[model samples]
Target: MSNLIQPGETLRVLVFGAHPDDCDVSMGGTVLRYVQAGARVQFVSLTNGNKGHQSILPVALAKRRQDEAEAAAAIFGVEKYTILSHEDCELTADLATRRQVTTLIRAFAPHLVFSPRLCDYHPDHRATAQLIQDASYIVNVPHWCQNAPIRGVTPVIYFVRDSFRYPRELRPDVLVPIDEQLDILLTALCCHESQFFEWLPHDKGIREVPDADHPEERKAFIRKYWLDVRKQYDRNRFFSCLQERFGEAAKAIGHVDAFELSEYGNQPTEEDMEFLFPFPVYRRETWKTTGQRS
Candidate 1:
């Protein structure tokens, strides 16, 4: 792991998730592309997922989750990983937890931070999002955490997609094409053995994908699972966004994942967008609601 404050170099990104697999499931492709583009990416999990399954022992489950997370990180080429060791299903937006996130923001000084949106059924997910959102804004405030150094600039915050939202207000402002990296995403997700085969079961009970000695059977199993998930997402929207950004080539693509711009600190300018994201094309909604001029 390369740990040094270089004078002028790569962009740093910090991804915070409520559970071990959240980051990988949502932003794994984007993370991989960032790392491949020579940026430093660090993933942090607020909870170790010990209480995720009742049948398994907590200690053993935690250990398995940690190992799986490490393996997934390795797949993404992420250098740094931090697990908060908090009990699963018990996260809160308390001062101490906020400070823990603040400490990391200070340490990494990431240019971009990805977290869950504040609209969710899970308490831990909502709490994690709130904590990260608060820490992102307050990290630069010297009075909040005096010991930690202030961030140079306020980082851009992004919200990951959720399975369901009650109010259904969250909207995507960014859609990154993951067609090339879907295989990697699947492999990374499959690392979490407990979540896939152990805990994930429909109303008809757990449907096990046959993993036989034959490579064809395994590939078919993976393809079926991946295709079903791909069908659930609004590929058309993502493809449109991608086409806007990447032109005709993007239009030819099939599937992609979306991300909503939950919070844009200080309102990034056009130049800033070019410097930070560098996507070729995009459309910005007029800031009419907030009475903020574009």
Candidate 2:
């Protein structure tokens, strides 16, 4: 069967991340775009995000992060949100975990899978990436995880954008314009207090962090301080890819999401991308109403 999903047919997307808010930070806007197009999106955090907070203990932080994940998932109206019990900074893509990941892929039978690249900074992120890669072929083998039915066709896998100039930089196969619904991403991030409001600021050595408790102030801080930093990375690194995909419109985009095609999953053609990436289905009224869900 062709990987291209028809307009009337609902799209199923499964996203795996190392930490609780990784999916929200990485692809929140793109996920909103999918849900707007009537796609069923599910987010899974491979780790419990226990080690992210400086003051909070591991067990307490893990529980707090789980609550934050549920809140953020509600913001996107995803089909489900799942958090695995793996220890932070200690995740391994061993055979047992690989089998578990394969079962997840087979159970959801996603049309496309979103995963981080094999490396960036975090060990958990790298392990999650390796997990997805290892499960790519096994997702189609019925005997691998006999309880869960096989996906039959391997889902096309895409690595979320990353910037690390070591072995090879990412090649942009898809560029998404998030200017329309950038606020939704921001609103979603507001749910993760420990990461956005506390730890990240301290980690960066920023003396004056936002009063993350206040809603209006928090939103403004996220936009001015955090998202702007991300915008710098995205613009300088991926503007050319945006120009390639979006042409003249790319010049005006304030926020963009970039993705790279993975060699392990089903290879999609240009036409297939039309269906795979639902940027064309975008409507101004569609996303402006996202607040209704929030």
Candidate 3:
């Protein structure tokens, strides 16, 4: 069967991330676009984010992150959000992990699955990527996981971009313009209070402190940090990728989410990508008219 989503069909999408905030940080805009288009989307975090904070205990931190993830899912309008009970930074692509992934794949039976790239800076990210790849084929096998029903076909899979600059370069096959969705994306990402307002800043040695107990102060701190630091440093790479693909018009694209086709899953054509994204073609033409190249 063709992997193209049929007319008027609601696409079922599943995205896997290493931690509670990974999916939202990486692809929140794309996920929001999917939801706005009426697609059913599910986000799965392989780890419970137990060690994400500097001060919070593991158990308390896990619960806080889970609640934050739930709040983010609500913001994104995601149909389902799950955080597996795996410990932070300890995920591995072992047989047990593969089985758990396969069971989820069989249960969700998604049309498209999103995973992190293998060459990530974090161990859990790399392990989650490998686990997803390993489980893609077995998801269709009838007897692989007896607890879950078998899926006749494996979902088309793609890898979300990572910040790591090693092993292999990222070459994206699809670029979804997220300029209009930036506010929504930021809103969803802000839901991950532990990560954005606490852990990340601490990890990076940024001195702008976050008061997790004070909601208004936390929001202000996160906004300042994101705008002054994260947006320029991290998000610029995404814009550069877009400019490479879409030319100077891509500069008009304030933000974008990129994906690479994974070899371990069903292959999709250029037309399939176009169908899946469904962004305005006129934006490209508009770039030609007013862009620096033209």
Candidate 4:
């Protein structure tokens, strides 16, 4: 086995977000926790978030968001912040986009890959998820694309949590707590002031929070809204599952982000699971607590 799989090896991960703030919102805490545990993490935004703000020019907003992302990455000790320069709100899971993602996947060659689910309300999120799924196998196919170097080994893939419930499609087999990394996540989140303070609610069809009336309360409301999206909706069960797998170390925490182990990529072994998921997991006995199993 490689030294990276050793007891104290630095776990590496690659996170893909459709927008500038997607990773921060969806898996920020997990990112923070990974860093805290001596993991090397990187962020990739499929788009520059040029269309993220109002009362600002597109070019200017993109640059601002990029700067903010860099600052946030610094806060989390992220090694790199890669922007694909794709236009926001118009992202498509085309061949070109998939190829770009493949290159990053090969270049990073992370043990784990995290990205949005295919069922999100946002088109960009859905597109990115599809792109990731497609590229999951493409990265390992030597002859798939001759131009770029192929990553022969397929890394384990996982999907980020979505708050919304859409009838009968649920695939999450694991949850990782972010409570330990909440502070770092928040610090990174604050970098996207434009979206969190201005645009996310507005774009989500939520009424805008006016600055004149209880600005702090409005900020609190927005924060809570995101927290609900990120934390509630089976997050607790996820933590419980982590507790089962990782024991007390992964438990004894609050706030969890969920993910569905992807069936499209390489199937990780027990050892891989031990490395990639260093959290307590749900046992048959504990399964009753959540009325579920992993």
C-alpha TM-score for every candidate: 0.84, 0.89, 0.84, 0.82
Error of 3 at 91 (Å): 1.0
Residue pair clashes in candidate 3: none
Stronger candidate by lDDT (1 vs 3):
3
Instruction: Give the Å shift of residue 292 in candidate 4.
Output: 24
lDDT of 3 by residue, 1-294 (tens): 354455666678899998998888778878888898877899999999899889999999999999999999999999888999999999999998898899888787787899998887789999999999888777877677888888564577888865466777665566677667766676677788788867888898987675657666665665576632433443466565566667788666655566777766766554555555666421122212221211
**Highest lDDT: which candidate?**
2
lDDT of 4 at 230: 54
The digit string of per-residue lDDT tens for model 1 on 96-215 reads 999999998888887778888888877888899999877866788888888888857567677776646577854656566666776776677677667754665332264765543544
Off by over 4 Å in 1: 1-7, 163-165, 202-204, 212-232, 237-240, 246-251, 264-266, 278-294
Instruction: List, residue by residue over 18-107, the lDDT tens digit for candidate 4.
Output: 987788777887777777677889999999889877677899999999998888888878899998899988999999988899988988
Off by over 4 Å in 4: 1-9, 201-222, 236-253, 279-294
Of models 1 and 2, which has the larger lDDT?
2
The best candidate in terms of TM-score: 2
**Candidate 3, after superposition: displacement of residue 175 in Å?**
1.0
Q: Order the numbered candidates by TM-score, best leading.
A: 2, 1, 3, 4
Question: How high is the CA lDDT of each candidate model?
Answer: 0.70, 0.79, 0.76, 0.74
Residue 238 in candidate 2 has what lDDT? Answer: 76
Question: Which is superior by TM-score, 1 or 2?
Answer: 2
